[model samples]
Target chain A: MSLLNNIYNQLRISHKYVNRLFKERSCYISTSPIMRDLMEFFDDKKNWGATEVKTGRSWTKDDLRIKSNTDLHKLWYVLLKEKNMLYTMEHEHNDQVRLFPSPERLDKVLDSMENLEEVVRERNRAYYELETTEIGEQTHKTITGPFGLEIDYYETEHSIPKEVNAQWQKEQNTKCRPEDVKSFLLKYKEKEYLQNKKQQRRNFNHVIGLLNRFPKMDMEALKEQYPDVDIEKAKASRKYKPPLVFD
Target chain B: MRLTQILYTKIGEWSKKYANLPDRYIKRAMEQVYWRNPKGIQYRPNTVVKRKKFHFTLDRPWSAQFAETNSPGRLHPKVFVEPIKKWSFFRGDRVEVLVGKDKEKQGIVKYIVQERNWILVEGLNCKLTKLDRGGVKIYIQEEQPLLVTDQVALVDPSDLKSTGFEWRYTQSGEQVRVSLRTGRIIPVPASAEETRDYKAKGLYVEQPKDTSEKDLGEVTFEPTLKTFEMEIMDQMGIKEDRIPKKSYWY
Candidate 1:
């Protein structure tokens, strides 16, 4: 599907002429048969020094879901090769201190690859759910770490069972001071609280300034916009005091 | 997070490139093995002490992510099979072998050839070989000539005839296979236990029609396509035993 993307078309040509052209010129055209392999890695020769290269959006999960397994598997390898080529070119360009052409090409390929995996994962989950009563997503758990803090750890397959594994046991059994960890967590929470408090103050002060500048300010809208800000307090602030004026 | 994933993916590509390095970049890659996890703390690879070992990192590169639990079954690395796209049929399903030595033979689906478009029917076709070695007779049973996807069709449970299958949800929001020919709500063997209690109690509601959820665009693989290594595999006569590796354009 990526192969036919963005090729120049002659839609303006009459159907009869288009048919004749295809028949005479050979329907299949290998523009760069000589550099077929190189085409995988590099963009067109014309785009060697071009500023930008435009491409289509990434493959969506729904789009990939519709593809047969064989097709998805085939496209995966194609995309994988494209990614490798893109990486090689970008690495070379970086080494030579040149701009990697439209770096988002790399992004687009990666996005497609990701979406492909997501689609595959969805299929796997559905299949597993039907065949077995479980969604076959990679499972993880929040376990207490060495620091006495809960950390998300992925469970992996082990050659030796956990009951008999010595190496894993050593990693799991680490000495931790609960007091130290509690202090550390408290400090972390305090930092977060202080940052949030500062933001709230800033928003409140900004609201006061706005109300002062505009006497006919929509108080209800302002209250809705900044729920954290005490609108009544902002209105009572000296900056927001109504200016006395002779009529 | 997205940028990190892209960079990590590039590192994976670099790992692959290490195999055919220009001898100039191997040293650069050896100096640092880039690895990271989305949520975990970042750290440099400080455990390495060699250069040659750096190659084949793509196969088993150092992963900083919390290790995954061991997978129970695996399609061989050489054999990258697609995950089952739909639950149209299953192992216990009674399928008719449409083409083979036992053509038109109806039998229960013994096992599915994972990743490959084939299935083995129970006790249908078997190749038996008797070998006498070291004064001992060995009987080897092999199930060959698997039923290809095109050559076989699913047999409906009601009439024991081939039929197209559709998906429909039960009253309890359970997905079930519906036999198109009979309009019989194929008991979701997995989810709802096809219980008389649910049906007798008037709890089961059949969906009006099996709606086509989405356009699953068509995708096809050139079955004949083979790489240079596959040709070698073919020469070795292990080609049939091995899945063909797809070409990686470089």
Candidate 2:
């Protein structure tokens, strides 16, 4: 279903581009060969069975920042198609038990998509901030959950107000009892405390080991690396014996 | 801070540059995640259990050889690495060996394992290894890594002699390595820009899917007081006559 939706969207975009081509009658031409079929999901035939597919780095936020909104809209679809094609290739290779060449290509595409979205968001934010007093992004709030833990709750559009919504009010009610919530919070705090203590102990032991090995090691650098570990305490530890020197 | 976060900082920038792989890819390839917190409600959100202590060697952190050496349940002996304030050694640097049979021999740096402050100089310190394959004995000389701090010294380009260097900024505020002996600039070699993808940035071969330099550099944007969606809609000739109904956000 999603694949069919993607195909429909691609066709609409291509149709739009074709219309624009006729309207502008400019020398703008796409370099890549357009299959306009399911084959578009796969990579070029020349890239098949290749040991490595060399590609340039992702589009950085700075690079995308200079591009116009129309250009960014076109680039978004380009990236979406590339991402789909890469995914199809990866799935096909996995099915055939063949190694996917340059798996980092997927990461690069994802990084580019993220940067592009961020750039678009930045532009939108700037315009919104200048016109309105808000950045005009999604609204979220830090609220206490039933489990006594903080939750980042993103606001959703609702047809009715909160006071009039009986179902929502009932669903928002705490499922756990007061005693249960109290117990859970107590245990959670204890667990957090234990974890912090364990980390401190690990750092202390590692520092002692370092002192034992490198007797002439730079104390300042060591302290900077592990600020929590007390160098004086680690030095005084029985495990941190100084290297014997013979006169 | 998490152990993985600390380990990530240990990976040197120069070492990453040589691989030319994204940090996300490197982390994904190298990490051994035994367990992870699933989506939805949980006691500890975003908690993960994974391998922390990685044995960084000549093999890249993302390479198959590195995975094999650091396979599950394989524990290596603890190695003590001295903490340095700054990393000065880089690839394509000419350095003279201070120890072993190749002592005083000048060679270019081939590889660097910054986690251990180790660098492999071309044809400097070597170890002979005999490989027996199909009843045929073949002896090959393999370059061994030397400590950048003590086992090797940078070669002064001015007199072609081994000399200590200091990092200094020029009049233009560009930081460069300067030979202390002659006070001459030890320029970073052009070969240092070489990576797994290309030898140099300008020399990179653009793939079929890559955007062309001409298209990428073209200034298509003209500052306008419009939101991205509004501009895109205008370009697409989208008309919205109906006003959106007021909705409550919760």
Q: Judged by lDDT, which candidate is best?
A: 2
* Model 2 Cα lDDT, one tens digit per residue, A58-122: 99988888898889988998899899999999999999999999999999999999999999898
lDDT per residue as tens, model 1, A87-185: 887887889888776565676677789888887666666666776767755678887666655666777766556777777788777646788878877
- For all predicted structures, in order, the TM-scores are 0.42, 0.87
Model 1 error, position B87 (Å): 46
Model 1 ranges off by over 4 Å: A1-35, A214-225, A241-247, B1-250
- What is candidate 2's lDDT per residue for B1-250, written digit by digit as tens? 5652485335787788878998889988988988999987775678888888888888888899999989989989877677776788888999999999998899999888888889999887889999999999999999999988678999999899999898899999999999999999999988888998789888899888789999988878888999988887788799888998888988
lDDT of 2: 0.86
Report per-prediction Cα RMSD to one decimal.
31.9, 7.5
* Interface RMSD (one decimal) of model 1: 21.0
Span of 10 residues, lowest total lDDT, candidate 1 chain B: B65-74
